[model samples]
Target: METGPISAILDTTLAIIFTWVGYKTAAIVWKYTPYSYPNARINAMEAKLLSEQRFNELAESRTLQNFVVNLEDTDYRDYLTGISTYNVEEIERSLERALAGTYELMIKILPGRVSPFFRLMLEEWDVRNVTSVVKAKFRGEPASDYVMEIGPMLPKVKAMAEAKSPEEMLVILEGTPYEGPYQRLLLGEISIQEFETELYRMHYGKLLSYALSKKNDERVILEEFVRLRIDRTNILTVLRAKAAGMDSEKIKSLVIPGGSVKLDPLIHVEDLSMALAELDSTRYGKVIRDVREEVEKDLSVLERALDKYILERMGELTRFYPLSVATPLGYILKREREIRKLRAIAKLIEDGVEPERIKELVGDVA
Candidate 1:
């Protein structure tokens, strides 16, 4: 295909036009999307609320009963009403609708430049759906009741229609991507603990590979962030298992392959005290600082501590990288925070918790 003079000129002109359009589109996005200032303010607020002392206190307490510590706003009332009204069917419908709208938005904004960011955002949603399905399968939940139908994967409601046992689940999921993990667990070749550990590793490992495949600069940072989050999760998981009387062999089998957890230190930790000491020796030492007291007294404290830790960490990252993938990620975190706040307020209002107690729970409620 030899290009004539006119054809060459037209091709060159179209190329220039497309390049300019792409540049202008990206410039507009860059200008409007830098919510770093607001993010920073929120991060500061989080730091104040989740100070080291506060974190230690949360870790020491079993109940997040303080979730609504401070309350004066009717906003919480509406939020609670909304949450209370959402039945399982309603939540599934809403999640599907939200995912469809988000995917449409992603397709529109994802020029060559933003494809990586779009995918990074989608990864979180993917994990949510996968985790939901896997758990649903374990509990013999119905597909419509379990799977959120908004992703690249084909809908498999029929496949899981009569799955009431793990063995039944394996037969149903035989050819699906989830089959391998489900089978590994169902066959007794692998424990549920190992299945959970490996499944998450596979998800994040795929995510990291996807990020690197994009060959983008900011994505490198996002990948590191993903890795760090996974490490924290694994650490929390190990801590909980130790509390549950899991042998070191089981703990080792369940630890995700990658990240800062060295096999030797992990193997040496026999009890909660030893586990905390070993954890203190790792890079996450700062993350689990002074958490032993809580681990010693109540295991539920670890859940609160982990939640507070991730919230604080994500809040900080949202501030640091406002316009990039972190902004949307932060928004997701904010939405979660809002949901929890709603739940807390609703529980408080329903239980008629004293205003003073509510104040202590949510902390200077608005």
Candidate 2:
């Protein structure tokens, strides 16, 4: 055989093997990539069931008995029916259980790959649970009651609840994404509020990384939504800090990165007007500007505006991307908000608060 021909044959054989391996690997990935079509119909149906009218009616019911009776006919009946008393504590417990149930349902329906996103969403609950545990441990109070049984973080949450000290709680978070923040908390390097912010930062960072790893239109929408959420969070934090008379340096330290709003202008903001001016050019500028007057009256008003803006934006994304994960995500957020509103109404009614006042607090679901 000629030497040149033999070399060429060897090269050709190697190329064919490598090409076949690449093709097979890609085929495997494609087979398990989790297309959004599997849950499209389910997402649409769920969104329809979360109508504003349903929430409005729940909010309108004057008495606990009336609220329970009306709720029995809704999807939340399973969670609410178990409550035999109208006590605030019982109502809060029922609301927590209902939220846990919602997460369980979401995990069951979402594809395995898609489930991670929902799990990341559930990290909020985990952070709250951990915060409650840390506070309880600080105050020497029992915390097992506040631990939420949702997502993979539940084990860590349980461990933290049983922890005797902040250091012990930090140990419970070891090997998890939250370990770094918890360690900082143990070292007294960050306040509890700052630690909570760090947990959120970690969650958003993980979600952003996952979204970037998937190069698809659906992931693009998800990534954008995540960015908007980060922006909303940062804005709310700044507003709250300002309301509490915090300085600019402290406020800047609390602002999480990876949001759509640039950091340069925000870092120099010393007051509400300055913050509004800095955010005026961003996507949320118009909404914040519109509510500036109300925000001055009460900083909490700005928080509501931020929530409504994010919810409305999510709703828009769901409408535009009905066949993607956006719809399911939108439904999840809307359902969570509805649950919160319902819980608030139940609490107010249990406290004998005025009906008009309760309605004002519930706000417009639409």
Candidate 3:
């Protein structure tokens, strides 16, 4: 068997290709190594998240005191410790503080480059703070009592609260990410709902933009979740506006971008029922259809159904992207769900509603 220089050159070329491939594989492996520590911490925190059964247990408590006592064995205990009355306001405040603590802890423990993802996500809280401030100002009340300390807009919270009118608030809000929403507010004849709608679009639009820019697993996880949120928010806005008899053009203007489906048709629906009917063709159609009858009876039930659907989707998809943004976002959403459930349970028990009925409302939505 005789071989020429061509055969030798071919062998050398193959060797070089294999070496390059090996180096790339190693680089990919090293890129994910930093996720190991934060992933383990997220894993530990996830184990502490309340299960469906635990939510049922919390629901079965006949009194707020019993409900508070039931929470003693969970991670929430630290947040609720030494609270004597366990009043609803006290309980809600404590739950909010606990959520803020979780956000701060996640931000600190996450890899520095990826930490900004969670921080951007937390801006929803700041938007909420602004919502309360502007609404209170419009109503001639102070918002300091209602403001919750959960997001990065803390430096401007005082200014936001001190502003006596929309113009003053707009001045305080100048030169911020939130500036545009108030700028829109300055345009005459905007309802409170419309004002909040702009905030939703700005917040989710920022999140989806940043997620897409990542072009990695963070994009894969956060982008899909953000789009889901946008769709949910848009759908609710349309239905509520239709129910309130708002103008179709105004309703259309409030719709946010980034949904997987076209939501513009929803704005033109003749009524609330018709709006829900319009959803019959979207990705969310099935979830909406499944509860349409109940939704007609109680619109709050529609919110519960949609929240459960997005969460279920997140739970299903995020498993593939673990050790990235998936774990932290999933953990925070699940924690928020638990607090909502607990709040419902406490409020209903105080209202003298039966435990079964409470569970029916706040427990697993089919």
Instruction: Go through the candidates in order and give the clash count of each.
Output: 12, 0, 0
Top candidate on TM-score is 3
- Per-residue accuracy of model 2 over 1-366 as CA lDDT, tens digit each: 569999999999999999999999996566434545555655655755645556567667778888878877667778777777777677677777777666666667766756777676767777787777777777788989777665568888897888777778777788887788778877889988788778777778888887777656557777887888888788778767766778877787788778888765765667667777778888888887888887777776776677778778877876775556776677666776777787788888887887777777777432
lDDT of 1 at 334: 48
Candidate 3 lDDT over residue span 31-128, tens digit each: 67778888798888888888888878888888888888899988889988867786787788788878888888887988776787778777888888
- lDDT of model 2 at residue 122? 69
lDDT of 1 by residue, 1-366 (tens): 676988989999999999999999997676445444544544453343333243233233233233322221322322223333433343334434444454445445534454455554454444456556666666666544655555554344434544565567567566755678767766678865566666677767766666656544356545655666667677776777777888887777777755646656755577777877887777666656756675678755555565566556656765665555554445444444444444444455455665456546765221
Name the weakest run of 10 consecutive residues (lDDT summed) in model 2. Answer: 31-40
lDDT of 2: 0.74
Model 3 is weakest, by summed lDDT over 10 consecutive residues, at: 317-326
Q: Tell how far residue 339 is off in model 1, in angstroms.
A: 2.6
Superposed model 1: Cα runs more than 4 Å off: 1-154, 157-159, 163-175, 214-216, 290-292, 299-323, 347-356, 364-366
Question: Cα lDDT of all candidates, in order?
Answer: 0.56, 0.74, 0.80
Residue 111 in candidate 1 has what lDDT? 43
TM per candidate: 0.62, 0.81, 0.88
